[model samples]
Target: MIGYVTIGVSDMARAKAFYSDLLADLDARVLMDLDRIAFFGQSMGKPMLAVCTPYDKQPNHPGNGNMVAINPGSKELVDKLYHKAIELGATCDGEPGQRIPDRFYGAYIRDLDGNKVAFFHFG
Candidate 1:
């Protein structure tokens, strides 16, 4: 149902490098890199994450209460990506753990641009 989520960033270079390295294990790459925007994903047609400068030419800021959640396919990958995000300079928003007994396991972090991203597994 969702195609892509766009997050505004103040620094394109840092944001691009941060995501490129962080999502590499998921096989996501720089699918598109334009002047003011870039898209990353495993491929076209699948869901993607985009980073861009605010279109109005004003400063960019992350929207409160907005977040992007990614399912890494397993609980183990959730932990792996969570750690990777931290190593890449993301601040931990939530630790890796089973949020719902026998059902959900997840971790959360704020990317370099302060965008909330969640890695999770749902069974």
Candidate 2:
């Protein structure tokens, strides 16, 4: 069980703007905001997504094999989220489409901080 997921960013303002607009698709609002961190979630207890500067005060870099997957609840929503990310300047890692016939439909992108993120739906 995961409680939350956090990714480090070098520019807080840019990261905030990108996530604020992107996560709005899921109706997730800012649940918490501190000097160097911000959390977004649709409800309490649900997994919250956070973006922050590293506490060690060193430059931040994207992890090579780590990613955050977001489930927006439907194939249509997945497509919408994928498009929204691209519109907001995210680079595409995969286009919106079925990944395994009728089992999984998803899309992937690298966010402003270069962290991989996925929008998916299962049927």
Candidate 3:
């Protein structure tokens, strides 16, 4: 239905750092870069996540302000990614588990700038 989701960020450097590690943890690649950054996954068909600088001017900001979800290859990888995001300075919003009633197993995390990111594995 779509190609990529580009979100706003305050600092490009910080945003790059945050997403670089987060994407690598998912075994994703830095496919391209422009006014926005694009991250590619191992699976060729997966949609890339694009991040850009925020245009709006605001005194106070909120967490992540947005959400970008990625899928881990396995349940173990999901757990690893969930904990790793925290180790890398990301705040864990939700721990890796069944998000719904036996539905989604995922971990919701916020990046350095407070942007929400998630990792999941149905298995």
Candidate 4:
């Protein structure tokens, strides 16, 4: 089972603010805030996402092929959050649409730190 995923960030303040505004649509908030890391989710019982400086103190770099996916529960929400991410400065990786006919609809983007994220609804 997944508890959380952490993305390495270059700027803590910017990362926090960006996620705060973006995830607010999903009702996620800062569940935990530490000096080097902050977690966001509606609650600890659900899977959470976090952003932090590298523990080794090295520069943060996004991993190739790594991504975090959020299921917003419907096609409209997938579109909504995708646009919201773009409005918050995320670059589009894929436009919101049905990725699999009659099955999955989704959108993808790279955040300010270049971490890949997906907004999807699966039926």
Best by lDDT: 4
Model 4: per-residue lDDT, tens digit, 35-106? 799999999999999999999999999999999999988999999999999999999999999889989999
lDDT computed for candidate 3: 0.71
Worst 10 residues of 3 by lDDT: 57-66
Q: How close is candidate 4 to the true structure, as a TM-score?
A: 0.97
- Please list the C-alpha lDDT of all candidates, in the order they appear: 0.94, 0.92, 0.71, 0.95
- Candidate 3's residue-wise lDDT over 1-123, tens digit each? 657776666776777776778678667766676654444555547677766665555422544345777777677888888787898888978888877766678888877767787888764
TM-score-based ranking? 4, 1, 2, 3
Q: Give model 3's clash tally.
A: 4
Worst 10 residues of 4 by lDDT: 97-106
For candidate 4, the lDDT comes to: 0.95
Which has the greatest TM-score? 4
lDDT of 3 at 75: 70
| Superior by lDDT: candidate 2 or candidate 3 | 2
Q: What is the TM-score of each candidate against the true structure?
A: 0.97, 0.96, 0.77, 0.97
Q: State residue 24's C-alpha deviation in candidate 4, in Å.
A: 0.6
Which parts of model 2 have CA positions greater than 4 angstroms off? none
Q: How many pairs collide in each candidate, listed in order?
A: 0, 0, 4, 0
State how far residue 10 of model 2 sits from its true place (Å).
Answer: 1.2
